[model samples]
Target chain A: MTHKKNTKAIKLVTMIMLTSVAQAQVTINQKLTASIYSDNKNGVEGDDGYKLIEERLEIRGNGQNIEAYARIDLTKFIDAPSSDYRDDERLERLLTSYHLGDWRIDIGDIHLEMGRGIALSLKPIESAGVDTALRGGQMAYQSKKIEFNIFGGEANPANLDTLSQKHVVDTPDRIIGIRGQIQANKALPTIGIFGIYLKPDDQKLNELLNAEKEDQNITTGITIQAREILNTFDIYIEGDYQKRRLIDQEETGKAIYSTIDLTIKETIILIEGIYLNGFEQRGSPHTATDTRVSYNRPPTLERIDQEVLETRDILGGRIRLERPIISEDYVGHINGMYRIQSPDSEEEITQIHGYAGLEIYLPDKLAFSGGYRDERYSGGALKGEKLKSMIHGEGDLTVGLEGYELHAQSTNELRRRPSDGDSGGEKRYARGSTLLGLERGGRMGLTLEYGYDTEKEGVRQHFFAGIAHWKFLEGQKLRLAAGTQRGGVKCIAGICREYPAFAGARFEWLGHF
Target chain B: MKYTLLAALLLSLSAPQSRADERPLAPEIKGKSTQDELINVADYKGKTTIILFWATWCAPCKKAIPEFIKIQEEIGEDKIQIIAINMDDAQTRSRVKSTIKRNKWKMPIILDTDGTIAKKINSTNSAPYTVVIDKQGKIAYSEEGYTSDNAEKWAERLKKLSTEP
Candidate 1:
């Protein structure tokens, strides 16, 4: 089934290319980039290195009344000598758009924004591995005074392979959604309404897990963004609401998320809140599905239902200010934020963070900067009350003279998270961590960085990073960077995954014709 | 030949090290500034000019302004000139100033506002950009995003620039 889908996509792309070829007025431009990374460590045996590479191609075209773009990433990886990296797969994004007078049509992987808020973002994290590329279509129309747009697509889960590995399901489950917006007077204010219908394709999964049928997951929301322009001062406000459906038998569950943002000169303030009253989906269990010896492995669907019922709510806000102390040569800024999350069953968590920094310029093309951040997080989980706090400070200085430049930075961090009553499941934070780096650039630039991190009672981490960007010929560039991160869980965004002590290196070359 | 080499060495040695003294004036634009002004490194003067590089899509820059405002307030007006350079493309130029006004920014902002200047400045294709020009027209400092400690150091640099002849 997947193969058939791939073939269909290829045919569609080819047909589009051919059609554009026939139309002499329409021009199509294409570009491709490839990158690879490898790794090796000291204590580890075997090759100790894995090579991952990706090739991306994009085609774009624009004419008097039409414009469109499409991109795809073809991925390949070499297995670690000791462990097989066999599950890697290739992914593609194809978007085609057409403009007819004031109306426009778009098909394939689509992203949409309503008002000032991002209502539909398929790829939330491009670097940290979370790629939620929605596959669907959209249509929009605009006039001199107003603009309207409607979009619908399928939501591909982040970890779909977890379910596929257990059963022979050819097609992963999907979530479908639709959104609309209206913008009046491109200068003044715009209001938008958006709604989505997420239906899980669980036909095979229901049979495999012996679960009952479920209704379509539904989400609907609205946003209001207004901007008031005065002679000397401007005021803008943006707010949004989003609701998600939680299915537990006939139990109806919903989650609402909203954000309000305001800005003044070098100052900006934002307040965001979220409340979950229904079921939310947690991550996959560590043990495989077949491991049911003493205690029954929690059913995946049931676990999802429980998560939705847990009722999680969060409220947060951030404020920032920046100003020039000495003309354009020097500037300073300060930022602070506070967040609190409360779960229906677990202890509520509260965090407060603040940071201050400054930059300076010297007469000899030398620049230096330093800053510090203090953060504290305290909360309780299913086990007992817990508290964690950290204070981190860092400074960097760079000197650029003649044809060469040198840059270095260092960070010192202290973290502490201790449990009150629970000893077995208690969490311990890093007592101290430090990072240092230096880089020099000229005809051939070189960078070297080292880091050492120690936890109160957990793991100690050591990291080394090096990179070189070399100019081979005129207009041609070659870059090589290698780094090793030992111990601790590596994370992107807030999501985390554990990898054994590993070292990695990447090399790439680029040239334009 | 000996005289020419000596002149060359002297010229290289005498090249102004400060961005303020070295930066040339905004050249005569054969055309008007109908929001299409090109922003190369040559348009600024006198004080160390800190350009706040920003884009409409950058959340961090948007959230870091309060700190920037406080720093500006503490630094006073005569010591420095803050130019908020918007990186919005030409298509979004119409909304640039209005957005600034709506955000209540008091700083004088040029429209690089169209992103042309950002591309020329070798920005990292990211928003919340901050670039510092020395008194002699040289790029003294540049960074993406805002942090408190960096803000302090930026102020310190401005102070240093003030004392330099």
Candidate 2:
């Protein structure tokens, strides 16, 4: 199909879907955000004096046993189109589903994730820019003991932003998958098996700079998973085998992941492990790792940057324990992990990390917490070899008064590394922050943070003012904040993203109709 | 950035539509619990019930569960019941089971891996969603998100709901 024709068809379908959804009793949730940045120095790379706006609209409705949802996002730069503007403004997601007696059918962008996302996952990772929406249809059947799912369609292009910027690609890659599970007997474990096949189309026009064409392969994989929850323990295991073939090269990958959680009284112990051989992890490269033929990642693997997934051969395990130290009010935790990785045609890297922490809760008035961490990494290539052995030790303390209304925290870190060429020394860092407001006394407050690095003799300071109103105007939640801070990694849940230094303002308002 | 003004205008046009009369009856949901037993929501029709849709990976859900537990304790089981419907997919089922057990929540929980029940209630695609059903089997309140002090508000609402004829 021609590009213009395809675009017109998509627009027509979108409008029809929107009109149908708007007629129903629907609720529209809208978010509008604008950020202004100004940085004189080059300290904050890729960010200059500019303004960016992001607009999001989500509509949801249910009628006649069918549910519908749509999200439209538009992002634009002020004045002129920034280099990145080409990647802005796209129909993010559209979905409609209906259920029959024992069967369900879903069409349009499907963002489904299966068993820990090992074999096939249509889950989008925003930070990593890993896209996984299938613009297709799914059929599912459920019974007392057996369930089946079959889906086929084009997977959202891996490089959505790049494709948006260029807009020359004709067809997205095709994806087909089938999954089934059987209870068989209630006394036995529930077992599931899934298989997926993917074939990239027209790679010549849709070239990606960061990805190697050799990496583009017709990939297929199958996964088997089992789960059993004993009286005191919960155990899960999954094994995956994938095969990829290019015109010249063919490779097979295998991975095994498992987790066991044992609960005894008030204490919890968890053991998780992963082993990979020639498995190039799949997700979004923007997501802190590599991308592969299949959209699968050992979602339970723990590492700083998914570094373990970067290697061709990898093995890792982690253990964590939580228990009461002395009484019901005091709790302690200990965790440790070790990993070894060998990147394809590269040197092997080994890492070991551990941490211990304790928290004491005082009856509704005050609380205190302290923690210690030790991290070490070694091995790699020449320049990376000099990057060789590096060790980091850190400690933190936090005290809260009146249930965190008045809170203060301090963190200190010491790092030791082998001298590169001439510089042979250790680095020390100390950081502190204070939060001054709770919901009761003040609707607005101030936050102050400072960080000092001894080796670089750099001092970073940030001051933020925030205000939150729960019942603003008409039962709306409005939160506003303005701040200036240094660039660093921001983490939510276990996902982390590195952001540039910024001085900006943020406003949020949430209301439902 | 000119779209900012357009977005703001769109936001201003939204009118607060009354929703109490439009809510459909709760779907009949029956699922296996982490304890390996069947739990049916319809069985609790005679008592005020709060069904909180949650997941183990959601930070807010983790925060809200403990508070819901406290609220359940204050309201007492006879006056009201709180059921947590887990929305984690099958891959994370084990994690969900372990997390609930470790927290020692006293409320009954149902595993809804397919999310059929949650979809019937509301399709916001998130955790920490809450629905309060009155003793007469009508939805009194349904909220899509959570705040720090929502538990106190829920307790107040439950107390008021318990007194309703």
**Shift of residue A13 alpha carbon in model 1, Å:** 3.8
lDDT for each candidate structure: 0.43, 0.56
lDDT of 2 by residue, B95-156 (tens): 56556755677677887654556644544446888888887666677776554545567788
Query: How do the residues A1-513 of candidate 1 rate in per-residue lDDT, one tens digit apiece?
Result: 543474357438633642452232221111222323343343335534455554443333333344334433344546534322333332344555565655777666554333222223332333333334445667766544445566655533332122111111222334344544455454654555666554544444445665565534444556554444452233333333334332434444344444333445543333344444442322212232221111001011110101111123444444445555666345465656555555333555655666666655442122233233232334444333335555666555555444444555564555555664547454544422233322232236676767665552233356777777765653255677677644444433233333344466667664311
Docking class of 2: incorrect
lDDT per residue for candidate 1 within B1-165, as digits (tens), equals 332342233233323422334432221111112122223333445666677777554434554565566666677666566766665432123235534643567765655421224433422435676766665555565554443334556677777875676
Model 1 lDDT on a 0 to 1 scale: 0.43
